[model samples]
Target: MATAKKLPSGSYRVRVYDKVTGKYRSFTAPTKREAEHKAAEFLRYRVDTRDTRLTVREVCQRYINERSNVLSPASIDRYQRILDKQLSEDFKDTYLEKLSESIITDEVNRLCGKYTPKTVKTTVHFFLPIIRKHRRDLELDDIRLPKVFPKVKEYPEPAVIMQLFRGDRMELEVLLALCYGLRKEEIRGLRSSDLSGNVLTIRRVMIDVGRTSVVRENAAKTVNSIRSITVAPFVADLIQARSGDYVTSMSGQAIYKHFSRVMAKAGYSITFHDLRHINASVMLYLGVPDKYAMERGGWATDNTLKKVYQSTFSDQRKRFDDMVDNYFSKIYDTNI
Candidate 1:
């Protein structure tokens, strides 16, 4: 407790007992009210300083260090970025005991607004294992996250894609994404030695993990992702002709920017990742079976290939409808 006293100089002074120093600490303010407020704030700071066991930032670092062995390098990198760049300063400095449901939900909503739903969900996932590890202190059920709505992806027509390949500098880059369904990181990670016998092995992935833009080479996203992919005859020829350590000298960011520019010149706007969707959709359109398509694309699960990647074009569906109508008409005429 602090006591305020009126001073001869016309200002009020508050004196608080300093337990550690075994002395009274005094502060002067213009008025008794100001003196009291200042003293109370100082007392609160002291209490907070003494009570803090661990900060959110410390917990995040601890989580990353403890789980580094189990988590993928990409996952570890993402968690580090979330803690460094995404989380609020107040949220990062907050003590574990002081964290509340309102605080967590507010931050989640803010993060969802800034990034994609999938990104938000993944970022929030880092908190779960950490909170559970301290279950004796925090109630995991207290924090509830908002639902992440799935987004509908758009892809360009096959003909339009073919037109863009006409002597474009990025033709090879575009072809790799559309023809092989390789991720941009996978493309950057490709080495010349990985290609042989018309098959390319996905052994490494290059990612910009932190704020510094320092790219890191790590293992593929999953064991299935590390499998080999066989290319078409033309693609195999293209790889054989290349004389470099990597498929391209361009960085991952450069590849994406150049690809976007090429697509824009062709009068369409789609991301490089959307090319993966284009590849899968074309395979489905060509009547390729799910198992073979899944194998070629290195998808461990068919649900994503069937639902997320496979999309039917309206023109293709119309053609099927016309064929069905013609068949039914011919059968009825024969009976007549």
Candidate 2:
């Protein structure tokens, strides 16, 4: 048995055998109180909770690593950046047991006031669940953690949602998205088996994981995602143009880029997903049932689309006024 000794600085030193790797290591800290507390905790844990081997950082690493095969490269990069650049710096050495609600809440508040509520909320979304999920999977109890983020923005403006859809090779995909509300991954993961004339089936997604590997056909995010969508004549033409050779890649960035070019040429600030909003807006304006639109958009719940994804009715009223006013001015060339 190794002895515990006091150094000149009033610190305590003790050697411990790591149950996991069966290695012995020495630890020195500034106080005997802390050393005894740590030592007792470790020895007790070695007997009662030896199986719970995950640290906060370790579990988080595994979650992100395993998700790489299913998430996109861009998404993986985003999650990793948050961990490596932000959360890891603060919580890397934090034992999961010591992490408290107050500590988490303080961190969340610090971040919330620092960035847009949207940006900060997303950061919370990425981390809060990650911690709890790992803890729960291990059947740990009463982990008094911080509050998860509330809903972000309540409803993101359709214009803002559309903004994310602009870019190269994105025209057709944009049309599908804005017109259909297809996610970026869903559009990129599309394949020939999902097509039959003007109807397209959405079944799988393509994701670039860890910026290194490309994984395809991981299936859609929900059961409702496996549905058929009718293609517009213009979109049909583009799809037709690519027939026999218009293949999608492991990454869908090219589709988005192409979409931006086409929208720019069409003289509209349009994007892949803007069309989705346009579709939703048009249907709502034309009085299509929200339930039907929800189904067409492959939305499982109407509340989210009505609350977030679908366009507002007020915009349609303003557009009606603007169209009438513009028509008269164009016909008569009036200044007022």
Candidate 3:
């Protein structure tokens, strides 16, 4: 607390330190009480004004800074990328108090023209929570966002994929994804110590943040993602043969590039991530129950397993449908 002092002119003056401006602010009045009250009011107004004047970019950065210790490196990197690249200068510079639905809607519309609906949605979703943390009065319910349609991905047959990568440099990476339904991060984080006999434990993940890779020990995408599953005999042998602290020394980029080249050479257009889907598809084809499949794949919920991973191969679906149609056709002919 600061006290008022008598001035040479018989008036009272009070000085208070403004930490935000790194300067002392002075208030003068005819009386000591009035001068102290004026200084108090000015300090209160300064704090309120400063908060209202905070820009979107500033608030977002502050939020990221405050949560840096708690948030994963991948998450921090994503937020930083969004702050740097995704947000428009106008949107970022807008004062938090001036933020409105119209402004947000315009930004979203602008994003839609340049990016996919999913990307626009992700950007908006990431931006909104930071705003709400500061401005609780802001209502976002009426903001219309573009609808995101699920992509129908076609993956190569398990046999074809295995045959292609059997002796390649990325065989272990492919095997982990295709056989165990491991995410690329999990595949990259695999260590020699995580393997015991035929069982392989998924206890960590290595994610790409900008140009660098970050490893999170005893951490995974989800609680269920941290699991252990038995590997086949041949898979175990491959693991045993690898001589390093990690199962594979290849970086995520190298694995993706090699996978893309192999798939392209085989006349298939697919991504490294598609191998996880192929694993799920194989499980579905073999009549594996949802419970077992979910456990094996480390999926958090049945809904996710069914919605994203569980898909019948086009050829397999056609073959099964054809069998049913033929049976029905024979019955109709007999009745006729």
Among these predictions, the greatest TM-score belongs to: 3
True-vs-predicted CA distance for residue 41, candidate 1, Å? 36
Per-model TM-score on C-alpha atoms: 0.67, 0.54, 0.73
lDDT of 2 by residue, 5-63 (tens): 89887888888787657787676777766766676666554522332345656667777
Over 4 Å off in model 1, which ranges? 1-52, 112-115, 135-142, 211-218, 301-336
Candidate with best lDDT: 3
Per-residue lDDT over 110-138 for candidate 1, one digit per residue giving the tens place of the 0 to 100 score: 88788877777787887756644443344
**Runs off by more than 4 Å, candidate 2:** 1-54, 62-81, 100-102, 113-115, 129-170, 212-215, 243-251, 254-272, 301-336
Where model 3 places Cα greater than 4 Å from the true spot, the runs are: 1-49, 301-336
Q: How many backbone clashes does candidate 2 have?
A: 23
Evaluation by TM-score, superior candidate among 2 and 3: 3
Whole-model lDDT values for every prediction? 0.68, 0.58, 0.79
Model 1 quality (TM-score):
0.67
RMSD (Cα, Å) for all candidates, in order, is 15.0, 12.7, 11.9
Please identify which of the two predictions, 1 or 3, would achieve the higher TM-score against the true structure. 3
* 1 against 2, candidate with superior TM-score: 1
